[model samples]
Target: MNEKTEELRDIFTNVTDGEETVTESQTATRGSLEKDERTIDERLENVIAQMRERYAFETTLTDEELIRVAKGFYDDVSDEDLASELEVSSEDVFDARLSLHLVESEADAPDIDLAAIRERDAADLDALADEFDASEPQIRRARRVAAAQDESRAANDRYRDEFDSILGDSELTERIASDVREDGLEDATEGMETDVSL
Candidate 1:
């Protein structure tokens, strides 16, 4: 319907007739179509390259956000096309889809009582997991994460208590801190030679 489309149609038509001689006009149209197609392809490639660069360095997009974007990209483009556009493997795309499902499932999961979990034996935990209709491994992972957090909190409390005890003697604390700073500075500068004559 457009000039270029008509020209392309004509080129294809001429090709189907194997015995027909290609006229100068048809030859020129064919070249023009190829050039135009190349330009369009180059533009598309440039855009995809820019998108890939931005996506790679974008720190604001969380895993969930990235998963959603990957899903959207996969839906709109073929696996090979999406992989080429994103400069990643098809396996990476599959992984993103899997991550999206995992994140969604995690979001839909019910909250567990971590304190009650800490009190429970292994058998009790398995029973609790059954009661919650969750997998034992999932419950175990949550419990492990919660226990690690509790351990971190306890370590922080101990550090705070130690610091408080140290601070109770202000003069001794200041002297000790000053000595540590001086020692650190000396060690840091030990390997470096400075020209102070100028």
Candidate 2:
């Protein structure tokens, strides 16, 4: 090779530290289809520990019960069902849900005004229930939902955030979506045959 070319090669080698291959580390969690890595319950237990360290507990539920609540919430289990399993009042489950930030947007009744209940969060439950023509449970639920939503608006809902962080990825998702559109959904969902082509 010419002297000029040899010098250019030397410069390139220096820049790359003489390594020809470049590799990037994959994300921490595996993709959805991977098998036998870690059970969802085990993973959730770990996440719950991390979250508890970051935030204080205000609910009456024990640490073990908190894990059950987090697991049940992720499994899409209803509060009433969790209450039955835990042998606790639905009110306790509701309180734990708020403590863990596992709240979903819901109203107590169709005509219930969340804004009105939010303003009365500290007011007497009996008076609010009477005024709204709702049960004490309904008023309690409305207050929790309203407060959680209001807080979620100002910051990310960490529990829902846990799902996306623990199970999804934005950059990889976009790239995969683009590739699927370019390749066609049928080939992706059903395996493409090599012999069949346009």
- How high is each candidate's TM-score? 0.25, 0.52
Please give, for residues 71-176, the per-residue lDDT of candidate 1 as tens digits.
Answer: 4542455546655666667546534433222222232224766666777886776697986677887687556545544543654534223323322333454567
Clash counts per candidate, in order, are 0, 0
Top of the candidates by lDDT: 2
| lDDT (Cα, tens digit) per residue for candidate 2, span 1-198 | 999998988888889899765578888963544243666556656766765676665677876787788767766788899999999987798777776667766522446788888777465899888888988877777876787666655556765576444444433555686876877866665865668668
* Candidate 2 to truth, TM: 0.52
Which window of ten consecutive residues has the lowest lDDT sum in model 1? 99-108
Clashing pairs in model 2, backbone N/Cα/C closer than 3 A: none
